[model samples]
Target: MLDGQASDLRVFALGTDRAGGMATAAQILGGAGTGPGEFQRPTALSVGRDGLVGVFESTGRVHLFGRSREGELEHRTTFQFRMDIEDGCILGHHLVVTGLHSEHSGVVHLFSTAGEWVRSFGRFYDTDNPWVSETIERSLVTCLEGSDEILVAPLFLPEARKYDVLGNLLWWTEFDGLRPIYLAETADGMVGVGTPEDGYHGTIGVTGDVDGGIAILQVGFITRERRESGSDPEISTYVLAADTGEGALLGRDFGRIRDIDGKGAVLSRGVPFPTLRVITWPPSVRQP
Candidate 1:
């Protein structure tokens, strides 16, 4: 059971059957009775007790939806923020960008639940790529705890930082770079960072033009670099905390972290690891 964000009550859920059909389900909670309307190719989705917040490239705007009438999801234009200028993650409360990694003047904008611009921490607009002008077309994903709290971790950066929904910098730490991979948070709050190859050991660096190897891990922040034991060599993964970078030594080896969510869960895998294929937590579930 995953979380859904509809409109400030309890956790909402959007489920799919074995036949690959999508539908909204129910959870007996001290909140609302229904969910928002159907969504398409949703990337970052969260459930708040009061409303739903997510990113759908089709709409090209971070949506704030709620129940309109008779258990129907209505689109409420609380905020129409866009961040594709520098492709990055935009979820309920977090916005992760690789502007620092790319150094091409990108943007990773974040907004409060009440629709307020908090903090802006990205490279200024500049021409880095000869092929492209001032645009970041590779956003990873955004993770959030509530409305004002967000974890802005890029795809292949060694460090993961946290910030308030208003964009207030919370904390930052160091890590190896892992590119050409993807990142996902677990139901229990652990981030499941993974890549195709095992490399994020500070051995390789992930640039947009270079075709670097990938890895994944389930780790958290620490004082210094450490390694995990009994990890699968097929894929390197890290389980990091949401911005604090406080965790354990998780890996058999190290590799470069990346911003591209390769052919993995963030892309396409048979089934979700650890837990049943939970899409993401909806912001509405956390709302009240």
Candidate 2:
């Protein structure tokens, strides 16, 4: 699962092994199409509070669909662009898309739910500051629940950043070895998982029947930041370790986690054979 949303009657799954197909609680919607409601290389999916589903295809298009009375996908509209979209999320009546250009610069574009382009800001590069250059190429965008802020994770930088709705950078922290690929926020704090840049591997028991098994160094952590009056936020980081029985859970390629009810998380291990697992926190240490 890439991203999923649940309505009163059905659940929606995107980027499964089905290839450009959107799966419902009972059936699949569209798959690998250039025609209406079809997708080619669907990269991200998000559902709004009103049951509207937004699917982002790698070919620079977004298809919006609604659930039918019979619990099926009903094609609504398509948002088209020229740049390659890396990831997207639905924020209320707005859609947020992030991607890179031929010039090796990153961008974040906002659009209306109706597919109207809003405004874009990014490609933050300052030749005078090498630190600023490292923060330019953002690869993921997700909304902070119940807040007007959005979090973005860079492709190569070991930092996750927060920005206001208008694209002003409010706060950021450097997580030395983690190269985050996904982000989710909850009432307690924000949780993220990513590949460890440093050669750090944890010993988890083997699964299936592979000899010597594989050591997975994927990192998951919960971070809490406190912003005081007229001061920068104080950041606290806790690195999480995988349980023994977890067993190569994070070794899968292109893995992501999403929060659930502030207690557990839904982990989606991507590609080849995709799998979804629901994991609880504390002892599990994998809270979305």
Candidate 3:
């Protein structure tokens, strides 16, 4: 649960007893879980912007499932894979996914609103590229509401890359010790990133491009560990930018939380308190 709320990402199945396809009645499995895919097995799942259930099956298919306007949930389509996990994001009409094969064979897979697979970006995962080699870099993509470009966050490779809507690499940056935890595109024509800083709290980082350089916003840290890991403690809420990855702050860490029922509501304290926190960027210096 995030901030005592549950993420919509869910997993479901058709049968109740075993790991298999759906039975007649069908069961919706959920929580942070994974199973077998086509070949490599099911590793991850997400609710794409299009509300389609995107599943990363091992055989290289970003399985798409969604409920139509009629409120029926079913398989929408399947994005095939030559040799990679086809991770994807769906904007209003555009869907962008990554096809990662190995250390030297990956590319960006683009799809249209009609569920038709389109073209790909980059040099088709060449092995000779300096920033990329045979090492196929499966880029992490984030689509901002207003922009056409997809902010591509590579898999912590030596260099970072961003791609436009037409599948062109826009920028490739290299940071010394900065490992990215959050990535998104902002309305200001810049990419937002969050990184962790080890100190009193976790740090959140954000930077925007200006004069061909990055401008840092607020740097904050997550302090939940201070309270959750300690004795009885009070808590405070958090405030972040309308978008994330503006300045670096520690990501929020939470312990278990108990006593919340279905649907949901705000919770401050509870008996037999477990860790339940909705994490975000920018730690707070102000006390509650």
Which predicted model would earn the best lDDT? Answer: 2
Quote each prediction's TM-score. 0.44, 0.59, 0.46
lDDT of 2: 0.52
Candidate 2 deviant stretches above 4 angstroms: 1-25, 101-106, 127-138, 177-255, 270-272, 279-288
Q: After superposition, how far is residue 25 of candidate 3 from its true place, in Å?
A: 16
Regions more than 4 Å wrong, model 1: 1-42, 78-106, 112-119, 123-143, 177-235, 249-268, 271-288
lDDT values of the candidates? 0.38, 0.52, 0.42
lDDT of 3 by residue, 35-57 (tens): 32222345444444456556555
Q: After TM-score superposition, what is the CA distance of residue 46 in candidate 1 from its true location, in Å?
A: 3.1
lDDT of 1 at 132: 30
For every model shown, the clashing-pair count is 93, 0, 48
Ranked candidates (lDDT, high to low): 2, 3, 1
* TM match of model 3 to true structure: 0.46
RMSD of each: 14.1, 15.0, 13.2
Compute the lDDT of residue 195 as modeled in candidate 1: 46
Q: Which scores higher on lDDT, 1 or 3? A: 3
**Candidate 1, 1-288: lDDT as tens digits:** 212333222233533344354434443221222233343323344434354533332233344556657765555643334433223344444333323222323345544655565555543224444223222223233444333444444434455555554556666555544333445545664546554444432212121100112123323222122234323223344545443545444563233233222222221221222222333324543213
